[model samples]
Target: MKLFFLNVLAILLRYTNASASFQSRCLAFSPESTIFNSTLTAREYVTKGTNLTFPDNDKSCNQPFQVAAANLCRIALHVPTSNRSSITMELWLPEQWESGRVLAAGNGGIDGCIAYDDLAYGTEHGFATVAANNGHNGTSGKAFLNNPDVIIDYAYRSLHTSILQAKKLASLFYGQKYQKSYYIGCSLGGRQGIGAADRYPDDFDGIVAGSPASDFNHLYAWRASFYPITGKNTSADFINAAKWVVIHDEVLRQCDTLDGVKDGIIEDPSLCHFRPEALLCQSGQNTSQCLSSAQVEILNRIYNSPLYGTDGKLIYPAMQPGNELKASTGLYNGLAWPLSQDWYRYVLLNDSTWDASTFNISTAMLADQINPSNIRTFPTTLAPFASVGGKLITFHGGQDQQITSFQGARFYNNLARGMSVSSASLDEFYRFFRISGMFHCGSGPGAWVFGQAGAASAAGIPFEAENNVLAAIVDWVEKGKAPEGILGTKFVDDTVAKGVSFQRRHCRYPFRNTYVSGDAKEPGNWQCRGV
Candidate 1:
């Protein structure tokens, strides 16, 4: 008994001393450790109870940074490039709450602003989080003018270098190596995460990407051509929100029960072939409930995959059905998308005041030649990433009109073919989830809430356990448990009706959620099986 107690006391003392050393060493990042041959612009040791405040003018999330005074070590790094543009990275270390892991996230849009909300969420969850400004520090594409170096950083280097530094800093601060590293992001941020995995294969063990803008140059070019091709001025002209609701109702009527349930969601949109021509108005029979021939043509164009006529090459993937309303309102509202404009002006044209209306196939062909986003954003080869035991999980909203959910499927299919692996084997490393009735990220008519960073929430579906993307990825990395299906909830919010309406489990790719035999409304009634 005495010997056992002595052994336990020795172990406790060792841990206590190690904890003390970790705190002291973390607080000393400003003075010690190798800089990885980079310059440190600033370092601050935030004590375990400090409140972080944002500028009043910064209305990003409309909430000032306020957390339970966490013990943190913050560091700012600058990596210089040939064109005199520098990559600025911020690393936040959790001193008091060490999760023995590093979580590196990325930015949205062409905006180089660090994602504060994502960083806060990571730190609060006991992760050492880091976010970069994607090379420049502004919300516009003006920074990319005549700056090829900054463009390269934005395309890839910013995340790669920042993650390298973050991991190093984590090891230096904790005096122990992180058990695993993960990347979490959405939209442009999602592209960054995949870019990191492609360029820097060993950076993360697991990654969760949502609505990724993978084909960077073509995506923007496609959006730039939307208004011209649609020949409509606003979403109201193309398909009003009310009209979309009508179309959605019709879609549900036709395909909602194909999954053996009429829950107002087309579970597998791939299985749905809802025809818009059926909604066409007959000659001499004009009605608000039906679309005109022109409207039907435009809808078909919007839903079909775009192909470049110049070389007969595919540009964008086919858009998922049922997102017509949101796409009409948010993405394809006839007006030029600002991000598309930014891509043409800064990255492609080098003219700050270039007219976007003149954007055409010729300009796109030229942009494709100088496509730096190709090697970084859309790496055709991901074997290096998979070789490092890295896992990628991406979720796309079926109702996401902005980027479309079909991009995920196209990318995965290509990835599997490129890697020479079967779909089942590909599922071992990469998995894609298609969320029904979910808009860009979340929030739509169906059970659209899955707890992801910048994701929508449903009532009673808190960001916990397997319901959360980050949590699911963490479990996959730490426990070698790959997620079979993710649970989604429909609840009352400002956008959705009140109360816990239903819970649906969205199965991973290759394995679909099928209704067997039971109460169709209950999640237990469904099982994940091969189609």
Candidate 2:
């Protein structure tokens, strides 16, 4: 009996040791280790959800996250790019890495915070994931002030160096080089992916960029321009939170049923002419239930007017319909969005006291002139991206209050126009998926959850090429199976436990979701059609 118990004990010990069995190899990684030249400054084997600490001042980067990751090797790096500038990055190497694959995440907004969600999202899929603080340690673009190298890092260098370091580290950690490398991010991170495609084409085999705010310099100008148009909260033309609700209801009343169903979502806002005159106050109507003529004019400009530079050139398109309530709460909350404020204040003027009251076309023209490390991700063509055999998938939400989906479509058109190639040829290397009713990266009345960054990661869905966008891109790169569309899930009340409310197969570029038969919620009832 004693001998039998001894054998059982040995088996139990092995089970307990499995997680830390890689410790020796994990601990072997340090700046001094010479297996490869590395800027890997620190290492830690985290367990029990310990918070990764940063310099105390960097509160933005130190937002407590689940570094409680056991069965993983966490690495910190500092890659010096130029005189007096470096990038802070983190890499998480999972033991059960999926088929020697590497995934790197992109940062959002003017953010220098590591995208821990994307990192978690990647690692959850059995990938070795890496993300950088984008050369600083906060959400403020003030880091760009008096720091041109840092600006350069934010522009494109940080992602390049971080990915290079991560790939090498991942290769060394696993005793083999990665078979494939990929990138995942949305918003600013999306811009970073495109920038990488432009400058560092060989860095990633597959990229999933969502709601990319490319043409960022002009986008900043465009974001700031709204403040002057909307006026201050005290202005007579200003639409308050209540009136914005009225506008959203009116929008739904007019455009919601255009897709052959009434689902409270405007699947395609472009088709809706969006007459603000309809919202004009009826006689004896309560002020809360209608807009004044002055307010009606503001709505017209917000939706119908195009932004132009002083040179009479179209700078950016107007805000598309269906995001009014969200806009009321955020950027249109009586002031310019702080991200835009930070851009104009720190990046352009470099004067902390400067206000955006005078943000006219000339001011925007100056922004275009400076361009700042060429951060504007507006590509004349993606020939270089295509020549290197890269596969790029970009998606923008139809209900996105932040960026107009039109810009995302415009980017696709630019790529084809620049290359003088047909959509079919461009479709070979790059594809754009327009997700109906998804706001920004995720959420809205539509099926918005689909393995995207941030909130979408919460679903914890099993990765499959059909269900997940990340897996779709992977299949595209590895198996040469290009995706026609992705299946988006809208959880009941946006909660996974409540069960799914609906599902839709969001179609790719040059195709629109056309309702044919059966049920509106059933994904198969809809088909991707060229309009």
Candidate 3:
């Protein structure tokens, strides 16, 4: 009885000490101190705390998100990288930070929108979180026009500088040095994550990049190539959303059972030789449920690797077979994707009037030569990052509609060849997981939610190393427990409140989750087998 009482007292004392420490630290936090030529523009200390519903007052950025955090110190900084442009960042310091870790989240697309949701996400996890508006502001990349400095900031400068500044600020606030640092990003954020690993190898100890748009010069080219094929929504070659559903069903019918399960996931897209011709319309067939002959040609171009020039050189990896459902929207919505439009016009050619119709196979080659703001990240060896003992976990959704899922494999294969190390050896430092049925970063027919950035963090999901890729990476960096498979959860109706519907332990690269026995929905029934 006495021992129990004493233990309770000790717990109380510890809690009191932590509370007072946070109080003092919060009070002493100064916004005046700046690093990397950054100006401390705003500071906010929240007492009400946040529950993913905090009202935002910062009007500096046109499309600022309503911050989803509470009980933290928020600091905003603006860094003028060059005479023509600048970068903006927001740093959050939480009271419950016991891990002594720093976190940086990447931005999506070419948007200079600060990852406010990510900042909130990291803060709740007890991390001193920071997110930068990848140079410029708002969701548009038009600012890249006539601003090479802005492009430079977007390409690499913003994230690197924001990280350094955030770390220094956290040290000042806590009066101690951080133990480790991490990065989480998808798409363009994933691109930035790769760039950080390549250029500033010492910045992050662990990086979790999902659907990384890494092969920048070619990625832009790949995205632009689609506009010419699909033309407009009214074009004869165009396919509607309803017919796309029919196509998705056809793809599943052909490929779903390849992994010995009819679970709607194409575990390995490579295993399936997708036949778009199989989806062709028969005479007197329901036109709405089938493709026209020209539409079949469009599907052929999409399913097969994109080719350019008279000699037919492959431009980029083919679109994954299973993403047809998601392919009906976003990048494939029969219009010029703004990011591609802006990149070709502003960043590459510096001609706003440069028609996207003129964009072709040679455009990709031209982009390679110009390489605006030096944003092309592919073909660079990750030797420096690997040498520094940096643990990297990159993932691409198998049903990804934005960027082709094959790029991650291409990157990993090259990494091993360049380093002259077998994949078994590379497993010690870096691993790439291919999440089945996941579209872009998250959400799809399969077990898509794996506790990544943004939505996953705010979804009220448990932050276990098994289900969370970020937690899994931290486990690798801090505890030396390398992940062979990341357990993914498919929430019922994509919401935690609805409860979990199913789960899958998504395998690391060179391996696909093979069915052993029992129910297909059961995660244990699947094993990571070599591809």
Instruction: Name the candidate that leads on lDDT.
Output: 2
**Per-residue lDDT tens digits of candidate 1, residues 1-531?**
999999999999997786677667765666224654567766766655566665632353344564533566777776665447777677877655556889988788887877766766677667888888788876778778887788888888788877777887787676788778889888897888788788788989999888888877777777787766665564444666677777777777878888887776777888887688888888777577889777787777776546474787877766677776677676566667788888888877788888777777777777667885563277667888888899888888877778867788888877877788888887777888877778877677666667567423422454565677788888877777888888887775534446667777888876778889888657888888887
Q: Which regions of candidate 1 are displaced past 4 Å?
A: 1-28, 31-51, 56-71, 76-83, 96-99, 232-242, 283-287, 373-376, 454-465, 494-499
Candidates in descending lDDT order: 2, 3, 1
Candidate 3 Cα RMSD after full superposition onto the native fold (Å)? 2.7
Model 3 residue 137 CA deviation (Å) reads 0.7
Candidate 1 overall Cα lDDT vs. reference?
Answer: 0.74
Candidate 2 is scored at a TM of 0.94
Writing each residue's lDDT as its tens digit, candidate 2 over 1-531 gives: 999999999999986686567776778766336323346666866553556554543676555645434367788776678877788888988767889999999988888988876776677667899999888888888888877888899989889988887788798888898889999999998999999998888999999999998888888888888888889888877888988888899988889888888888777777777998997889898878888888888888889987888788878888888888788877677786788888878888887777877778888888888899999899978787778789999999998988888899888888788889998998898989988888888878888888877445546466888888889899999899998888998888888888888999998878888888888999999889886
What are the RMSD figures for all models against the true structure? Answer: 4.7, 2.6, 2.7
Q: Any runs in candidate 2 off by more than 4 Å, and if so which?
A: 1-18, 31-41, 47-57, 67-70
- Looking at candidate 2, what is the lDDT of residue 384? 78
Best by TM-score: 2
**Once all C-alphas are superposed, what RMSD does model 1 give against the true structure?**
4.7
